[model samples]
Target: MDRSAEFGRWKAQSLSKADLSRKGSVDEDAVEVVELLNSREEFFTTSSCAGRILLLDGSTEGSGVQKQHCCWLLVTHKPCARDDVMAALKGATSEAVLKFEPFILHVQCRTLQDAQTLHSVAIDSGFRNSGITVGKRGKTMLAVRSTHGLEVPLTHKGKLMVTEEYIEFLLTIANQKMEENKRRIGRFYNYLQHALKRETISNSHSKIKERNNPLCTHKNRRSQGKAQGPSTTEDNGRELEDGDGLEISAALFLGDD
Candidate 1:
C-alpha cells in the first residue's frame, strides 16, 4: 500500500474506539492505548480525527476552547500523550500551532544587584538582557522594572500596577534568562581557569630556564669608549669620551618644559 493509505489504516486501528464525551469513563488500560495513538506521527492530522469524535465534540477544533488552555480534551476520553496536544490539534492540518508556543522567562528583582543578577540570568538562559526602563511614575524614585519586551506599569509605591497575568509573564521571561546566565558563567569560569593554569605553567618553565642560564644576568651594561684623541669638556667641565677612550667634543641643547 502507499504511505498515505498505510498511515490512514494505522490511524484507523488506533483511534477506532475513541470516545468523544468529555465526561466519559475511560478504561484505565485505554489511557495508555490512547496516549500511544496520540504520540504516533499519523495522530496529528486531519485524517486522524476524520471519524473520531473530539472530547468537547464541537463542530470545529477551537470553537469552545479557551485561549492558552491546557489539559483540555482533544479526542474524547483519549489520553493526551504528546507534550503539546492542544497546540497540535489547533494546527494539525496547517502546522502553525506548533510555532505559537512563545519563549518565556521569570525574573525577580528589587535592587540594582537583583536587577543585574536577573540580567545575568537572562543571558544564561540564552536571551539578551536588552534593558530596563521606568514602567510607571511614583511619588519616590522607586519604579517598576520592565525587561525582555514586557512592560509592567508601577503604582505610586513603585510596585507593579498591572494585572497578575502580565506580572507572571514578565517573571517567567526573567527566570529563563537567569538560567541561561548561570550556564554561560560556568563555561566562562572553566575557560578562565584553564587559561590561567596554562599561563602559570609556561611562566614557571621560563623562570626555571632563566635561572639555569648563567648569561641571563639582570645588571645593565655600561658603554666603553675607544682609543682616540684628547677628551673634550662641556660648559659644566664634564669630559666627553669616544668609543676608544678618546676625548670628544659635544654640545648640549635644552628646551623649556
Candidate 2:
C-alpha cells in the first residue's frame, strides 16, 4: 500500500467531516488557528473546540461525578457575563457547577514525525496534556490540550452556596482563563508556522545540493549512460538495436523506436 496516498485520502475524508459540523467556534482566534493548521500539507484538523464556560447541574456518585444526569443551564465559548450567569443560576433545581474548559484540538497527521513535532509544539505552548495517539486505521494523531480548567460548585440542592460577590469573582477568573487559552492558541500557531517554514527551507536546500553535486541530477545520469555505453533492448525472440525505444529497468532509451 502507498502510505502517502493513503494519508492524502484520510486527510480529505477528515476535512469533509470537519465541514459537516454546523457549529463553529465562538472564539475567532481559535478558528483562525484551525484554518492555519488545515492549510498545511502535513496536518488536518479532525475535531476542535475553542473552549467554553458551562453551568451544569450534577451530583457526585461513588467515585466519579454522575454527569450523565447533568443538565446545562448555560454555555458559551466566550467569557460569560455576570448577569447571564446569575440568570441561569436562579432556576437551578439541583447542585450547579460552573466550569471553564480550555481549548482542545485533535489533529490527524500524515506521519509519526509530523505528529511528534506537533505534540512538542503544543507542550511548549503550555498545553501540558498534549499527546500523540494512534488512530483506528493506524494513523498518528495529536491531541492538543491544556491543564487550565475550573470546576466549582455554585449551588447545592437549588440553594445558592455563595453570594453574588463570589459568583462574580469566579466569573473574573473564568474570563482570565479564556484569555490564557487564546494566548496559547496563538503561540501554537506561531510555532507551527516557524516549523513549516524551516521544513520548506531544508527541502529547498537539499534540492539545490542534489543539483550541484552532479550525482543525482539529469546531467549525472547522462554522463553515467555515456560511460556505460549505449543501452540494449530485446524483443520477442529478436535482438533489437541499442537505440530502440524501450525501457530497460530504470534506464531510458531516449530516441524513437
Candidate 3:
C-alpha cells in the first residue's frame, strides 16, 4: 500500500477508541497536549495524568527506610496550600508523607517508527524517563514522563518530626516542582511541533528532487520495460507496453510489497 492509504488505515483504528483525557477530572494543563496528539494522523492519546501533590499515611522502617502503602490523604493536581497540608497531617496515626509527582502522558502510535520519533522528541523536551513499549496485540505505546518527584516523611508514630515552619518550606519546594513540571510539558509540545514541521518541509524537497532528476526517470523507464516482457532499447531507453509501464511505475513509487 501507498503511504497515504496505510496512514488512513491506521487513523481509522486510532479513532475507534475514546480519549480518556477529555473527562472532567483530568488535569487542566495536560488537556491541550492530548488534543494536539489526537489531531495528528500518526498518534492517539490513550491515558494521561498532569501530576499531583499528595499526603500519605504509611509505615517507617529502620533509618532512611520506609514502605509506603500507596494510600493518599489529600491529592491535588495544582499546588496545595500550607493550611491544607497541615490539616491532612493532624489526623495521621502512622507515618505521614508529602509527595509531588511529575506529569505523565501515554500515546499510541501507528508504527514502531512513529513511536521512536516521538520518544526522541520527548527526551529532547526534558522527559528524560520517557520510553516505548509494545503492548497488547503489538500496539506501540509511547510513555512521556519526567523524573521530577519528591517523597518526604512528615511524621512518625503519630508525632510530628518537623516544625510548622519546616512544613511551609517543604510546601514551597513542592510548588516550585509543580511549576517546573508545567514548563516541561510546554517544552514537549513546542519541540514536537517544530520537528514535525521540519519533516514536512524535508518531504516536500525530496518530492521536488525526485521529479526533476533525469537518472531517476531513466531507472523507472528500465523497470517498466522489464515488466512489459522483453522490449528493445530505444533512443531514450526502452519502450514499454502502455498499461504495464503505468502499473510498474506505481508499484515502484509506492514501495509495495
Candidate 4:
C-alpha cells in the first residue's frame, strides 16, 4: 500500500484502544520510546538528565521522572533575526534551539522538567510562549495541563506525553507565523515600490526644473534686450540738451554702448 494508506492504517491500529495497558509493569516499548524522545541533543541529552533530575528532586522526591516528548510553540512579538535566535539558543544550557530559520525555531526535550526549562529559556530570550499540548498512544504516568481548551489526546499514561503534542503545536504556530511574515514582507515591498515611485517622480520634477530654469532665464534676457535697446539709444540722443553734464554723459554713454 502507499505510504499514506500505510500511515492511515497504522494510525487506525494505534487508536484501537485509547490506552494500551502493559501486562503489569512499564512496557519495554514505552521505555524505548521515552529514551528515543529524550536522546536528541535538542531535548534533554543524557548529560542534562542529571541536572534536570536534581531540579525535579528539589521540587519533590516523589515528583517522579515522567518522560515527555513535547514541542514548544513560541512567537516573537517583533521580527527576530535568525542569528539572534541561534545565539540565544547557543547561550542557553537547558534547551537547545534545534532549527533557526528566519524567525522560527524547533526544539525537543525528554521530560516536562526539561520542557519547562527550555520554555523558560525561550521566554528569557524574548520569545512569547504561545501554547503547548501533549499526546500519547499508550499508558504512562505523564500528566498534561489541558485546561486551555485545546483538544488533547489522553492515554492510559497519566497525561498524554506532551512533548510530541507540543512539537506538533509549535509547527502549526510556526507555519502560521511564517504566513504572517510573508504577508508583512509583501506589504513592505509594496511600500518600497510606492516610495521609489515617489522619489522618481520628485527627481523627474527636479530635472525638469533644472532643465527649464536656464531656458526661462535666457528668454527673460532676450526679452529685456529687445525692450530696452532702442529706447536707451533714443534717450541718449535727446540727453544733450543739459550742458557740461551732457558732455560727460555723452562720452560715457557712447563708450558704454
Model 3: how far residue 236 lies from native, Å: 50
Q: Against the correct fold, how does model 1 do in TM-score?
A: 0.25
The RMSD (Cα, Å) of candidate 1 is 30.9
Clashes of 1: 29
Q: How well does each candidate superpose onto the true structure, as a TM-score?
A: 0.25, 0.76, 0.69, 0.25
lDDT of 3: 0.72
Q: Residue pairs in steric clash, candidate 3?
A: none
- How far off is residue 89 in model 4, in Å? 14
Show how many residue pairs clash in every candidate, following the order shown: 29, 0, 0, 11
Instruction: Write the residue-wise lDDT of candidate 3 on 1-257 in tens digits.
Output: 76546655766765675554434444688887888888878787767888889898877655555554546678888888889988988888888888898999889887776676677667766687788899665668899888799999988886889988998999899999999899888877776776556445545655575678745563454343334322222244454654211111111111111
Per-residue lDDT tens digits for candidate 4, residues 1-257, read 75345434543453344443223222222233234334333231111100000001011123448733333323232334434433333233232333322222233333343344333332322234222234363111122111111122222222223354464554455445544434432332243233334334544555565576755453454333233222221234444554212111010011100
Question: What tens digits encode model 2's per-residue C-alpha lDDT throughout 1-257?
Answer: 68888888888876665344446432565777788888888888888888889999866544655435778899888878899999999879888999998999999888776786577567656787887899778888999988899999988898889989988999999999998888888777776676566556555655676778746764554344333323232344544674323222111122210
Model 2 CA lDDT for position 78: 80
Q: Tally clashing residue pairs in candidate 3.
A: 0
lDDT of each: 0.31, 0.74, 0.72, 0.31
RMSD of each: 30.9, 18.1, 15.5, 34.4
Task: List runs of model 2 lying over 4 Å from the truth.
Answer: 18-27, 62-67, 209-257
In candidate 4, clashing pairs total 11
TM-score, cand. 3? 0.69
> Which candidate has the highest lDDT of all?
2
